[model samples]
Structures are given as structure tokens and as C-alpha cells.
Target: NNRPHPEYSLKYNKSRENRLIAESSYNHVITFFEGLMNHREIAIPIKHIDFSIGRICVLEVNRDITQSDIHILKTLAKMMYPLMISDKKFLNLETSRFDYVLSDLMNNPKPNMLLMRKKLSNFKFDLDSNMYLLCLCDLDNINSKSKVNYVKQMVQGIFEKHYVFVFDKNIIVLYNNKNSFDYFKKCKEYEEFLEFIKNYTLSVGVSKLFDGISGIRNAYFESLSAINFANRLNCIYSKEPSINFYDDYVLHDLVYDFVAKKKLHYILDSTIINLLADNNTNLISTVKCYLDCGENLNFISDKLGIHYNTLKYRINKLKTKYFIDLKNPDSLVKLKLAIIALEISKGYDLDLGLN
Candidate 1:
């Protein structure tokens, strides 16, 4: 068992010791470089080499460098400075490299259209049927600025292979099948998803999904409508089914155009606001009562427990102020649109005139 001679044993021990020292030094250097690289405020120092040539240079660095190393660094720097000045085109190319990197990241398809369709097939989302797109966004309760990033990450985690886009302040999620709807609706896990979102101040909205890219605009609007409905009703899910934009194209277009152009307040006035405010802004009661009363003076008064004269005065005042005729059927429809638009404008900054 003790076959090694003294010289052999000594050599083995020295070799092992050197190996350990080398490993330790390597690890130390790696750690030092990592720390330096990760330091946010640290920058490589650049020095002017020649004013006439507009040459800039940076020295080669070595830890505990000797005079020879410094001299070599200076020589290298001098050479590099002239090249840098003479080849400004390369510097521009370097700048373009960063732009390319960003573009690649953005377009590299974490989940592209083809991938999304394939993944959705696993979820049994029918490509041929009418679908709905629902987007759920969660806001950060602690740091407001971090909300978008946090929601983006969360959405990415949940919808791993789905395409997501950040439009303004909201995360846009696209869903495209009846199976997808049923799955989300019936899954017990959905409750957990809802809970997780709620913890981060979340909201969910579902849209009527159409067949193509053209339908996407409608789906987006419907999802937003669902969001507005939920907010007004104080409910998590919308009670009504998604509205078909095609079926009601004219009215939808009018409403959308008016809202897009920011002219909704011309059809609703302070009286409507005061009434809504007085009723604790109860959407259903206000809307239903307004419609059921046949825009009649006496009927609304009795239902709302106000004098008939008071109702007439309020109605007349609203008509004059907003220049809207509630008696006409078309104008009445427009009034309803105005109400919905006002509710939708809550979390958004809309220049509705009455506001």
C-alpha cells in the first residue's frame, strides 16, 4: 500500500497544490470581471489621442499591470485611435448593430402567427368558427411604472405560444375559438388565474372574435366594451354576449367614429352626469329607466320619485345644453351611445366636451 518513494510523493503534493492555486485564481478573476461588467455606472474610459485627427482611444487593461503592459496599451491605443478616426463609417455601423439587435428581439417571434395557430390547435381552438379575443391586464399596486412589464411577463407565462402586443397601456391578447372560450369559462384553473390577476389589480375583457384580420378590430372593440361593461356593473365577467360589429355596422361605425374623433360629449350633458351621479352612477337603472319611461315627463318623475315638473326641467335642460333631441328615435339611440362612451372613457383620457 505504501509503494510511493519520497521524491514521487513530494512531486504529487506540489502538483496538486499548484492546481488548487490556479483554480482559485481563475475563479477570482472570473468573479472580478463579472462584477465589473455588471456594474451599471461603470464605463470604459476613452482618451483623446490626436485633436487634429479627432481620434479617441482607450487603453488595454490588466490587473496590477507592469510598465511594459502600460507601454503596450499606449501603443495599441495610438494605433486604434487613428483607425477609429479614419473609419467613422464603422462607428455608424456599430450604432446600426444595436438597432438591428433591438429589431431582432422585437420581431424574432417569441410566438409568431404560424406558431400561434399550431399551439392553439392543441387547445382545440377552431380556425373556422366565430371566436372571441379576451385580454386580461394586471396593474402593479406597488410600483405603478412596473405595471406594463409585469403584466407582459405574466401574459407571456400564461399564453406561452400566443401572440401579444402592447397597445398603449393595455396588453392585447388574441383568442380564437369556441373551445378556447369554453375552456376558459369552465376550467377550475381559471379561478386561480383570476385570483392571480386580482392580486395585481387586474381586469379581463372578452371580444367577439371574427374570422380574419378585419375581424380583429371588432374583437378588440368588443373586448374593450366588455371591460367597460364590467367596470360599470362591478362584475368580473360581462353578462351580455359579445356584440356583432358586422350586424350592427352602421351604428357601430357611427359610435366608433364619434368616439375616435372625441366628440361624444356633444350628445350628453351635465344633466345626464348629475342624474347618473345622483343615482350613485348606477348604469342599468339609469339606462333602463330612461328607456322604459318613453322619454315621457310624468312617467320618469313618478318612477324616480321626482316631481313631473322637475323631470321636464331636467330633460329640457339636457336637450338645450347638449343640443340633442331625446324625442327622436335616432337621437335617443345616439344618447345611449353617449352613455356607453362616457363609461368607456373612465380609465382613458378622452376630451369629451361636457367633461
Candidate 2:
């Protein structure tokens, strides 16, 4: 056993020498410990014996150690090394396979789109069985890369059915829906998701459900839109911002979609917008509340924390100054739509008297 093996005489090129040097640099310091991780009763935990590439775990048994038993164990250990190395290599390849296909789809989507999709589908992902929602997290407030990685691990553990990735410093999620849960049911989980983001100074945007591979681009756009909406919502309300779902802002997305389809961004009246943007007084808010509350002045008053008489005065003044006849159902609807559009478009920056 002390003699040199026959393979030691092999010639080395620059690349081989470099590989040897790199291998030598990594501290493979093997650690031995005996303990029970929970209830399993680990007999031996040989930590990082293969340069951070492998760990050996052999659980304790009832029998006493013998020379023959040790020899058999050593033989088994030698046999496992090759399999362990191969498994590690396969896992690395598996982990990075998605990255290559996704990069191709994002960067050059024209050629082999179907082929790339097929390639993606072959990799343990079933398009038909999986419902997808895209998520984008804003990590501007996250202090360090270690924190980002920790967040990633936490999210992955939390969202087990999700495929989480980091692209261009943003965490992107391709979430798989549970077949039993509907949109709102699945969304209940976000309470925890958003809470995590809030505690970690993170904000996230979640896309609406998309059924198939073709909808991936749409889902991404939805996530992007939700992020913008979330940021706007964060600034508008004093409440802490954590997540904004695109589905929650259905009206805003609808408006944008309508404009996109019609190639007309100016469908809403400029005068109405100007009035909403003025923020001169509380008239716009009063009108919005009146319409929103179905003309229930008392409800609106209670919500706004204003006196009934004060709300009435504001409503009457809104009708007078804006030339909006809240008395007419059609006019009230128009005013309400305008106010919503303004809220979606400008948040509180334009004010529309809501402040």
C-alpha cells in the first residue's frame, strides 16, 4: 500500500497542472463528530472530506465494531466515492440546465422557441400540470449578498413547489399552483410571504396565474406591472409595503390593456385628469367615496373620519366646482372611473384631493 501506484507516472499539461493547484488550494479538512441530529442518532458525520463536494454520514447501529466489519465498511466507502462524484456532477448539471434554456428564451426568443420549451419541459417540469405565477422581489434594501442568499433559501423552503432564481440582482420566482387551490386560496399564502419581505426590508410583485408556456412572457410583464403598482401603493398609503399582486389591481391592468389594445392612451378625458391631479381640495376624494360607497354618505363619512355635515359639504362643493352632477348616475360613474384611473396612474403624487 505504501508503494507508488502505476498512474502516478502520467504526464501533466498546463491545464492539468492548473487543476492540481486548484485542487490543492481548497481545504478539504475532514471533521468527525458523533451526535444525533434530531432523532436519527448519527453514528458518524464525516464533514466535507471531498473539498466541499461531499459529506459522509453513517448512522449508528446496535453492534460492536470489529476488524472485518471495518474492512467491509472501508470497501463500501471506496466503492461510493465514484458514485458520489458522479451524483454531484449530475446535480450541478441539473441545477444549471434551466439557466441555459431560460437565458436562450429571454435573449433570443425567435429561433427554436418550441425546442427550448421542450427542453425545459423535459427537465422535471410539466407545463400542463403546473400553473405559473411570476414573482419579482425588490432587494434594494437588502444589505448584503449573504442576506440575499439567505432570503432565497428561506423563500425556496417556504415555497416548495416554486422554482426560485436570481437574475440581474432580482429574485424571480416561477411558482407552481396547488391544484386544489384557486387564486384567492393560493394568495392566502402571500400573507406569510409578504410578511417575510416586510421584515427583511424587501418588497415583491406577484403576477396573475398563467396556464401554459406561451403565457410566460405575459406573466413576466404582469410581475413587472405589479412591482410598479406595489411601489406606487407603498408611497400612497402609510401602511408598510410588502407585496402587490397583479390580480389585486385588475382595474389598473384592465385600463392598461384597453389602452394597449386600442393604441389609445388618451381615452380618459384630459380635463377629468387635470381635475383629479389638481389636489386643490378634498372634493375628488369625497366623490370617489360617495361612488365607492354606493352613495352611502354615512358609510363614506365614517370611513373618511369626517363629520356627516362636513362630508355633505365636500360632496356638494365637489359637484359645484367640478361641474360633476353626482345626482346623475351616469355622471357619478364617470367621475368614479376617473378617480380610479388617477389613483392607479399617479398614486398620491397627483393627490386628487385624497390626501
Candidate 3:
């Protein structure tokens, strides 16, 4: 469209006109405008077209408006609508294939690498380089699809090279490895994202950087393990959104495996069994905190919001009644293992019976 005044600019009023187009109720809106210098009248007709994925507006500028012109424009819009809808469906179909193929590859214990490469060739993914896997878990569990798509968009806005998809109701992001994945943790965008989702109660689990396509399944499990540990530790709901790193949980994986193989009652000693059976959760929490704090009295007191005297009293009660010697290396080890075993039992909903 040509303007009567070539030097005149409508940039200042574009936002207001766009708002008018967006908020209008009708399928099409027409507005009359006079040229800046020529004073010639013009008709600007706009038609908002809807597609499966999103909406777009079709606009035309005409010297005069008539029923025939309106019909022609409406007819053109109607003709273009189905093509746009078809394109959207085709795009969605291609995207769903990516989702399905990735899920299948992740689930298969041993996938055919050649076939995998062929399958994903069209997605233009860089499977040859090292990458980091991230899983975003929605605490609410409802609206999984919508939340996944929203998070995917947000992540793409920040990451330039990545493959993002949804699997098992959680959003999975495959970020091409930078010099260090730790860079993402410190980036301003990540902090802003955490702030953005603070109200959504989301937890993020990130895998260590892994090499190539062969390591994807391992990375997937690593991310899931991070999420598992975060939930077991009650970090999901107790604080702001958490971004758990698998490297941080590698040491704990040994204890996790130990508890996974043995029954909690069989693993815990008589003292811990009796302590748990006593039904004083506060005391149990204090003991866990005491062990976690490495027997630092002041730290334990501060962590539990109890006075030093109260903390000492609780420690004495455990020593006298439960015969737990915090000074003894063997006893301390047993106590620490018992705390973890109990947490696994409770957090993972395993058997809690003493028998």
C-alpha cells in the first residue's frame, strides 16, 4: 500500500491501531483515514484469520469501500483459512512424530543408532555434540500439556540451540552443551525464569553434560534421579522453584541404592527403630538435622529454631533413651544411614513396617 504523504509516519499510532484490531469483536473492521497532506479519504479494512496454532490478521487499503469489495476480501480470507489450517495440522503432525520418536528412543534400552539418525534427520537436531538434559516437573500435575508448551517456549526464548519436547507429562529440554552447563545456572535469564515460575511450583532437574546421542537415555535417567532426590528431600514445595543438578546427587546415589535393595526395618538399627516407633517426629527431625549439620550444636539449634539447651536436651534424650552415641563412628554411620532409609521409605512410599 502507498501513502499519499511519503514522508509521513504512522509508527507512533501503530500500537493503538494494532490494539483496536486485536480487541475488535467482528471478523473484519474497516476504518476511514484521510491522507496527511493530500486530504484524500481511504478505507483500511482488516480481517482477523484464525488458524489451529494461532491467529493472523489480513489487511487491505482501498480508496473506497463497497459491498462488492467487502465480499471479495471476505471470500479471499475464507479461501486462505483452510490452507492455513492445513499447514497447522501438518506442522502439528510432524511435531507429534518428534515427540513420539524421542519418547520411544528414550524408553528403548538399546536403540538402533542408524535408524535413530534417519528418523530425526528432518528435525535438524544436532545429535553429534555433547548436550545437557533438563526435566521440568509441574507440581500441580494438571494442565501438563499446556504448561509443557509454555515452558518450552520460555526455554527457547533463552536458548539458541536446543531440542525441547514433552514426555510423560513433563517438559524435557535438550540444550546443546556450552563451555559449561553451569553457565545456565548463573545466567540472568535463568534467574528471571525461576522468578517467573515461582508461583507455579515447578521443579527442574538437570543432567550432567553427556556426549552425543548414545548418552541420551543415561542423561534422561540422571535428570529424573535429580527430580527424585529433590522430591524425597521435600525441596519441591518447601522453597521457591528448585533446579536440581544430578552431579550434586551422585554421592547420595550410593545410599539411595543401598536403601532400594533392603527393607527399611532391616536396615535401621534398634535405636533408630525405637526412635521412629516413639512417634516424636520433632525429635526425629532434630536428629536428622543434627546429623546433617555434622553435630554442630549451634547450627542445629539455628536450623531447628530451638535454643542450644533444647537441642542438647534432645541429644541427651536420644543418648540416654535410645543409646545412640553420636561420638562413636560406627553409631554415627548407622544413624546417618537410618535417617536416609527412613526418608526413602516415607518419601517414596516404601514399606514402613518395623517387621
- Encode model 3's per-residue lDDT on 1-355: one tens digit a residue: 4433543323212223422343232244443345444332322222223212222333343454567865676566556655755654422422467888898889899999999988888887677887899888866443322234555666667565568777766778888865788777687877776764554457788998998878888999999898888777774236555788999777556566666665555556778778866768878888778778786899889999999999899888889999987778888777777776676666776565655
TM-score of each: 0.38, 0.59, 0.61
- The model with the greatest lDDT is 3
Q: State which candidate has the highest TM-score.
A: 3
TM-score of 1: 0.38
- TM-score: the better of candidates 1 and 3: 3
Off by over 4 Å in 2: 1-95, 108-111, 141-145, 178-191, 250-265, 270-274, 327-333, 344-355
Q: Higher lDDT: candidate 2 or 3?
A: 3
Any idea what lDDT model 1 has?
A: 0.47
Q: Which 10-residue window in model 2 sums to the lowest lDDT? A: 38-47
TM-score of 2: 0.59
For every model shown, the clashing-pair count is 1, 0, 0
Q: Please give, for residues 1-355, the per-residue lDDT of candidate 2 as tens digits.
A: 3332333211111122322322233312111222312122111111123232332334334654455654555466556666765665522322356756665555554546578668987777666555555564644432223334555666777677667765544566777775522553467675777666665556666677777656666677677788776677567666676566788776666655443343223445544555655765477777777777787878899998899999888867766666666788767656766655666656635323322
Order the candidates by TM-score, highest first — what do you get? 3, 2, 1
lDDT of each structure? 0.47, 0.55, 0.66
